[model samples]
Every structure is written in structure tokens, then in C-alpha cells.
Target: MQNLENGFIIKQVDFKDNDKILTIFTKKGKLSVIAKGAKSGKRANLLDLANYIEFQTIKSKGLDIITTISMRNSFHLSKDKSSLYIFYPLEVISKIDRVDQDESQLFDLLNFTLSNLYKNQDLYISLFNIKTLLYEGLLSDFTNCFVCLKPLEVDIQNISSMMGISHFGCDLREYNVRGYPISIDTVKLLRYIKDLDLKAPHLGFDIKETVLKEILLFSTNLLESSFDIKLLSKNYIL
Candidate 1:
């Protein structure tokens, strides 16, 4: 039987001669499918990374086999370094273990991000990072310290690269983790972004270069440290 799944191609690798293996992030979750003899054909183009595609696959004892596929959205964006930033979030999504109930939101986020990443690059990138933390139940409350459980009035000092928000002089090392010294403004920005609906317009998202860098850095740190995986797109984005 052939099952139809729509997803974004996150990674692709050469299998044997003329075959390609794709790791697609579908609404069901992450799936690996082999495209037999797809190395040089229309199927090859359809399997390109970051392309949104609907494909049919047959289950097997090993990897699923892609029987037929079609492109849904090519994104038509440049494959340059900066534009390839989607890989940062895609890589994270590909690695993390998300529940089935969360798949709908995750799939929608990737779809939206790919649609708007070209024009709203920074906003979507930051949104992806902050929202992923929220979906994964990792983002800490911005109003209080995750460590001391005390009310954090405007003096927040560090944001955990993986787990918590903290006040000044808190001992994050005691938890065997590291964090970046963050500003109240950045904290407010993150909290604000997190609360925004996925479909809401980000009309007021113009951010200072320094603060934007902080958000990116903290997000990168969070993904890397928490998952124990290095994001290939990290160097390009930062």
C-alpha cells in the first residue's frame, strides 16, 4: 500500500548508484524514505532539500520506499549561505523527538516559515527558535527566574542556552549548564514573540542588530546544547 505524506525535505544523501535517501519532516513526524534510481531525474529535483513536496511511499522492513512524488512549493529562494538559514530550524526539527499531537503545529510552522523566510528572514528565524522552545516545553517563564523561583523584576541577567531564564548572579553552572547574558529588552522581545499567534503579522519586528544577534546566539546555544547536535547552518546565520 502507498501512503501519501506532505512534508519539507530536510536532508538528502546519496544511497548506492542512482538512488537517494531523504529525511523528510512530515505532519506525522520525521520519516526516512529512499528514492530508488532518483539520482538524475525529475524525482531528483523534487527531492531537493527545503522543497515542500507530497510523496507516496510504501512501507518496508527497512526504510520506506518513495513510489511517486510531486512538488508542492519549491520556495524558489536562493541556495546561498544566508538564505539557507531554514536549515537551522529544519535541522533542529529533524533531530528533536516531538509528539504526534504537536506535529500539526510543527508542520504549519515550517510551511509558514518557508513561505515568508525570504522577506522576513530574521523575524521568522527568531520565531522558529523561540516557538520551538515553547512547543518542546523548554522555554522558561520570562517573568521569573527558573533557578531561584523568584520574581524577576527588570534585572534578568542570563538566559539559559537550553532551559531557563535567570536573574543576575544566579549559579547556572550548578545545574551543569551554560547561558548567555541577556538583556531585559531581548527577554521582552522573546516573550512577546512567543505569545504572538503563528498567523499574526509581525509589523513591529524591526530589531536592533546587537539584540538580534543575542536572540540568534541564545537560540543556537539552546538547540546545540540541549540536543547535543551541531547545527550546520549556525555558522552561516551568525
Candidate 2:
């Protein structure tokens, strides 16, 4: 049946030159779509990742195909690193979010997150934490233990060799195999990211690079183990 759905583009890849596959986190489906002829201007450039818009689609028993897409005003203001990091969630989305499923809440969260991401690149990690929490259905604030739910106060002691950070009493390694520490900085960052109004610009922090690495590593471990996806981003980073 022909249908309409609203969504944000998660990932887009060229198919046969003009055809494109768009993994859209839609109000109804978190999976990707084969938007035939999208790259050739057959559709407005909703193929752009994070482009928020409505789509005309055809639903099959198996998969839904996007028939047409229209540009919405919300997508035009973003630029730079903000644009890139917003797509990073796909590293997680591609793994967990299912296609052809009703997921309007996920869609709204994605839209709001992207809006924030476009305005605040420095807060990308925090935003990433939010997406991760949404996927896991857990709270994103790192202030509490991923375990005991007790407020923590570590000064960065225990860390994973892969990205060990022993500050905030979180130590779940290898897809959260259970033995590692998360730094206070990670927790603090999460707390700040989840609650701070993006409308308010971040005042900046004094956390060291090592602490940042711990958060990244911890999140990476969780996401990779949970989703079985490789973040080639580490390989490509210059």
C-alpha cells in the first residue's frame, strides 16, 4: 500500500550511480530504505543524512520504499563537525533500530538531537551518550554507576587498557563484560550534556584529553559489543 512517513536520514549510499539507499530513522521504522533514483534529483535531497522531512512511501510485506521526499526547513542551518557527529549515531542505529517498525518516539529524539548537534559540536559526545541511552533504554547521565545507581566520585583511577579510565567507578569492558572503570569526567560530561539546555552555549571544561579518551573508549566498548558494528571512524581519524 502507498503510505507516508516522516523521518530523518541516517545514512545514504549510492546504488547503481543514481539510486540511493537511505537508512532513515522514521516515525514508523528505524531501518533503511532503497530510495530509487534519489541521487538523480528524482526526489528532493532528503538523501542527505539528518535531513528532517516527510516522505511518500510504498509499503511491501517485506520492506518499504521511499517514493518521494520533500525538504523541510529545519535542515538548512547546520554545518561542519556538528553535521558529521550527528551521523555517528548511525553506527549504533544501523545495528539496533529495526526497519518497518513503529518508532515515532525514536524519530522525535533523533530530530531533537540533530538540532542540538548542528548547534553544538563540542557537545557531540554528550549527545551520543543520549542516543546510546535511548537505544539501551537506560538513563544517559553518567553520574551514577552503570551498576549500583549510586552517585560516584572517582578521580580517574581504573581504566581499560583498550580505553581504561578509572575515575568514576565504571569498569565494564569488551562489550561490557564486567570489569573496568569509567572516569569522573565521563560521568560529569554526561550529566552536563543531558541536562544543559543546548540553547545555552557550553562554558567549556578543563577535563584532560585522557579523560575524554576514557569516555570515548567506554562508549565504544558498549556500542560495539551491543551492536556488533565496527566504528571505522577510529581508523579514518587524522
Candidate 3:
């Protein structure tokens, strides 16, 4: 039976001769399809990473064989920091396991993220990482201390590697992880970003370089640990 789906080509791997195996994240779900003779034919260019496409496939024993593909939108990346900004999120999304409850939201988030990266790389990257964690339900509560369960004081000194806020004198050894001493400003920035709507206008606040670094580090670590996947594109971001 033939099936038609609209989605982005998240990942691709070379197969025998001119064939390729593609991992597609569609509105419906994730699909692994083999494109027979796609490498040297008209279909080769259609399957490039981050290109949104509509494709036809035949499912056989839990695998799919691609029959035809039509490009819907092609995102061009420049040889600069902007390219790294765009590619990292794509790479991260490709590594995500499909969650039935969050697939549509994830798809929209990715589409929105890629669309906005060219306009404001830093804002979108930070927003994307924060939102991805929320969507995946990986973030711990931030309103109070994870251990004490009390409101966080201004002088609180540590952010747990488990993605929780903590106090200065908390027994870090109990958590079996080293904690980063985060400033109150960085914590506030994260909360502010997390509360903003995806379509909200660009953040008007001036984020310090130190705060930005902390956000990226915390989000990256949380995602890697939660998903059990390493992000190779992250190297480019740093």
C-alpha cells in the first residue's frame, strides 16, 4: 500500500550503491524510509537535511520504501555562524525520539525555530532549547529549592545538575552530582524566557554574556542527559 506524508528529512545515511536511508519526522510521526537510487537521481537534492518535503512511500514489515518526494521548503544555510545556529537544532531534533503526545508540538517548534534563526540566532537558539525541554518534560521545578522546597532566596548559590534550583549550603553530594553556582539574574532570565509565548516579539531585555552561557550549558546538559543522545552540532555553537 502507498502512503503520502508531509515532513522534514531529519537524517539521512548512504546505503548500497546509490540508495539512501532517511529518517523523516512528519506531522503523523517518525518514519524510517529507504530511498532506492536517490543519491544520483532527481530525488537526491530533494532529500537534503532541513528541507521540508512531501513524499510517497510503501510500508513493508515496519520499514518504508520511498517512491517519490517533492520539496516544499528548502532552507539555505550560509557558511557562517548562522549556519551553525540553524544546523544544531536540526541535529538535535533528529536525535529526539518520537513522543506520541508531543509530536505535533515538536514539529511546530522545529518549524518555528528554523524560520526565526536567520532573524535572531541567539534568541531563537535559547528559546528553542528551553521549549524543547518543556515539551519533553525534562525540566525540574524552578520556583523553589529542589531540596528544601522553600522559596528560593536571592543568595541561593547552586543549580543542580539534575536541572533543579538549590541553596548555597545544600549537600551536593547527596545528589551525586556537582552543581553550578548560578546567579539570580540567570535564573530570572530562564524563567522569563520559559514563560514567553512562542510568537511573542523579540525579548527586549539585555541578557549578559555570562547569563547566555549558563542558559546554553544548562539546557544542553539537561537535553543530553534526558535523551541519552549527544549533540554533535553543539560543538559549532560553542
List candidate 2 segments past 4 Å from native: 42-44, 59-63, 73-82, 97-102, 138-183, 192-214, 234-238
Model 1 residue 172 CA deviation (Å) reads 5.6
Question: For residues 1-238, what per-residue lDDT tens digits would candidate 3 score against the true structure?
Answer: 5766789888889988998889888877677899888888777789888889988988767568988789989876677767767678778888887656538877888888887777657666877888888877776556777677777765455554355667755536457566777777777877887777876655766778887787777767767777889988888776
Top candidate (TM-score): 1
- Select the stronger candidate by lDDT from 1 and 3: 3
Instruction: Compose the digit string of candidate 2's lDDT tens values, residues 70-186.
Output: 877455434544455655655556666465666755555556656665544434544664555645565434544444444445433543322222222344422355455555566
Q: Score every model by TM-score.
A: 0.88, 0.65, 0.86
Candidate achieving the largest lDDT? 3
| Local distance difference test values of all predictions, in order | 0.75, 0.57, 0.76
RMSD of 1: 2.6
TM-score of 3: 0.86
lDDT, residue 157, model 2? 51
